[model samples]
Every structure is written in structure tokens, then in C-alpha cells.
Target: MSRLALPTVIALALALSACATSNPDVIGRHEAQRMSQVLDATVLSSRPVVVEGNQSGVGAVAGGVVGAISGGSVGGRREGQVAGVLGAVAGAVIGNAIERSTTRESAVEILLQLRNGERRSVVQAQGSEQFAPGEAVILVTTGGKTRVMRAPPVTAAPPAPAASH
Candidate 1:
């Protein structure tokens, strides 16, 4: 690989890995310090699922650039131009596939029943927490996005002290 190609490939890799995630454990910087709505619910069902991948075009662009550069070094000027175009087209397709595969995530589909008798279904990327049917969990919503997590154990409140006479 050429001097410029190695760094470009590394940068492309880093960019691909930085794709956004819907994991319940991950909170965006913008969501920090924001108030969220919480609802108590019980898992009616939990099943494994796959989250579809994203196609943001970053991979295609990066791949095209790399391909052009690599192909431009071949043969004479006319041959190099033709090869560069062909390489770019091929690279773009490959890159798109790579992006899709890498961005795909293992997720779960959870059916929940709220205390008010309302039912809701949510799909989220798998994280440190796992859910099972009949498990207590909380649905936290912030900025229109919601995540499900295991609810904390309930504890009794301390008794109030008697007023002095």
C-alpha cells in the first residue's frame, strides 16, 4: 500500500466504528443532565432480535477515494483513468456492504405491561442488562427516545419522627 493509503484506511476504519448505537447502556452527550420520564412496567416477553444496519454513505465515499487513488497508479494515463473509475465503483459497493454488516447489532424485542394496564413493545440493542418474562423493568424516556432497564428493588420508606410537644 502507498504511504497515503494506509492512513486513509485507518481513518476509514475509525469512522465506521463510530457509527451510532441504540444500546440502552449508551447515553448521548446531549442527553446528559436532561430530565426523563420514567414508567414502571413488567416484561411480558423478551426475545432476541437483530437490529438493521445503517447506510450513511461515509463508507462509500471513503472507499471511492481509496479506490481511485489506488487505481490511478496503474499503467498509462488513459488506462489509469479507466481503472480508477472502475475501482471506485467496485469500492463503493464493497464499502456499502461493509458498513451494513459492521453496523448491524444484536438486539432484543421486549413486550411490557405498565402498571396502568397499557402494553408497549420496544426494540433495543443488547447491552449489559438482560430481560425475561415477568421481570420488573423501567422504561425511561428522554428526548423522544426510550430505553428499558431492570428496575431497582423496592424498599420501604423510613418512618417519620414524632413532633416535639
Candidate 2:
């Protein structure tokens, strides 16, 4: 095989791997299934409020790789190594910044009630378009992370009896 051909194939492979896709962390439906538990949150407030935040991962990783490659492409072998490290740092910073600017975070504040009749206001992370205020949703809590899941609204409990003197 030609020397140029090998390098070209490698470059193409790396570039292809850098592309974004639906597979965040490449874990597939496993994480989605796990996230379903958070969808069971109870509603406390009659009306829900929407809040936005940034979700980051792909940007950081892609930035790191791109930075490393750009850096390594500098000068000779020794300089290239140095460049790679610096590039990675710069890339990560830029990547995170870009992600922060481009991607809308999936966190929102909602009022919910637990089965035991406790009412609380909580902030939960959710996917875009999946959770909305005023729309019925389920809150799932798992692995110390809380997420809002798309679900049918839970029926409200009957009002308590009035006290008589």
C-alpha cells in the first residue's frame, strides 16, 4: 500500500469519529431506560415554569481531539507534542464556550408532590422538547440526578375534610 494512502485512511477515520450523532456516550437505550425513573415526579404547582441551562459533553470531547490534532500538526515532533497539549486546552475552552452558546440546557423548576403528600419545588434536568411547564410530566430521580420524563398527568388527590369545632 502507498504511504499516502495509509495516512489518508487514518485521517478520514478520525474525522468520521468526530462527527456528532444521537449516540451521546454511545450507551444507546440503556441510559434512556434508566432515565425513565425520573419521569415519575409528582406535580405540586398547578402551573409549571420553564428554565434553560446547558448540557455539555460532546463539545468538550470533540474540542479536545481537534485541539490535540491541530497542536500535533505544528512544527516538528517535539513542538507538535507541545502544540497538541496547548491545542487541547484551547480547544476544550472554545468547545465548551461554543456548546454553551449553541445548546439549550434542559433544566427547569417545577412544583411536585410525592406519594406521601409532601409538596416541594425542585429543579430537574430534561431533554429538549421533552419537558414543558403546564404540560403534565413525570419526575424520575436516579444516581443522584433528577430528570423530567414525558408522562401522563397524575390525577389530583381529593381535598382534605374541613375541621369542625
Candidate 3:
């Protein structure tokens, strides 16, 4: 394989690893993961969340490598080496900026009052329902993290049939 600069190599690695955050144990799209606590809570309030962008440096390193490889492909050997170095530096900067901007996510912060009379706040990804104050919701907690969602409705069972004469 052709030689790659450190930055270029790093950038490529980051790009390939973008999907590492996906959960492998997910059984279904809408199902919640088993939690330590599942309780009904009242939504005291909710606020929009602006998640910070990633600063993993993966972009810079990966970009640098790609830039270097393409740069080295041009001109003579000595000139190609110089171009590769320049390309790597440029790639790193571009990659980092692109990653920071693209990786940002919108979320929500919910303040809940549990049935146990304890109050707490949770930050979770935004779902179908936009939370509102005074709403009844369910709290699911696991590993110190919590998610607030609207509670499923209770249904009454049908009465038994009468005996025939």
C-alpha cells in the first residue's frame, strides 16, 4: 500500500469509526432498555437541549491522511513529499471543523417529580412527543441515567360472560 501521512491516516480512522456509538443490543426501535426503575412522574418542566459537537480529533487526523495521500500523488517525488506535508496540515483543520459541526445533536432536558416525592432532572434525546410542563410521564432509569416519556394508558379488562339458561 502507498505510504500515508499521520494526519491522513488518523482522519480515515475517524471516518470509519463514526458508527461505533450505535447500540448492538437494541431489540426494537420503540422499546426501552431494561431499567432499574420504571415509575410514573409529573413533568415539572422541559427545556430544549443543545448538545455540544464532538471534539475527538478523529476528523483532523483522518482528513490529514487523505489530504497527504492525494497531495503526494501529484508532481515529482521530492515535490510530492512537500505537497503531502502541506496537504496533511490542511486536511486536519478541515476535518476537525467538519466533524464538530456535523456531529451536533438536539436533545431535551426534563424536570420530573416522581411519585415517591423525589424530584430530578434528566437529559435525553428528543422523541415523538415534545414534553410540556404538568404532563404525566414515566421515568426509566438505568446505570444512573434516566429517560422521561409519556406513560402508556391503562386499559380495563372485559367482564365475564353470563351463563346460559
Candidates in order have lDDT scores of 0.86, 0.55, 0.72
User: So what's the TM-score on candidate 1?
Assistant: 0.89
Candidate 2 per-residue C-alpha lDDT over 38-148 given as tens digits, one digit per residue, 9 for 90 to 100: 434455443334343243455556666777877888899999999989988887776666555554333456676655666666664343534344555555555555555
The candidate that achieves the highest lDDT relative to the unseen native structure: 1
Q: Could you give candidate 3's per-residue lDDT for residues 1-165 as a string of tens digits?
A: 335455456555556545433122222333454546788999998998777668788787777777788788879999999998998899788878777776665678889898889998887656667878888888766665556768889689898899899
Please give the ranking of all candidate structures by lDDT, highest first, separated by commas.
1, 3, 2
Task: List where candidate 1 sits over 4 angstroms from the true fold.
Answer: 1-3, 158-165
Clashing pairs in 1: none
Q: How many residue pairs clash in all the candidates, one count each? A: 0, 13, 11
Instruction: Point to the candidate with the largest TM-score.
Output: 1
Give the C-alpha lDDT of model 3. Answer: 0.72
lDDT of 1 by residue, 20-119 (tens): 8999989999899999999999999999999888788877776777777777788999999999898788777777777777888999999999999999
Instruction: Mark the regions of model 3 whose C-alpha exceeds 4 Å error after superposition.
Output: 1-36, 155-165
Clashes counted in candidate 1 amount to 0
Each prediction's TM-score against the native? 0.89, 0.39, 0.70
Judging by lDDT, tell me the better candidate of 1 and 3. Answer: 1
- Which is the better candidate, 1 or 2, if ranked by lDDT? 1
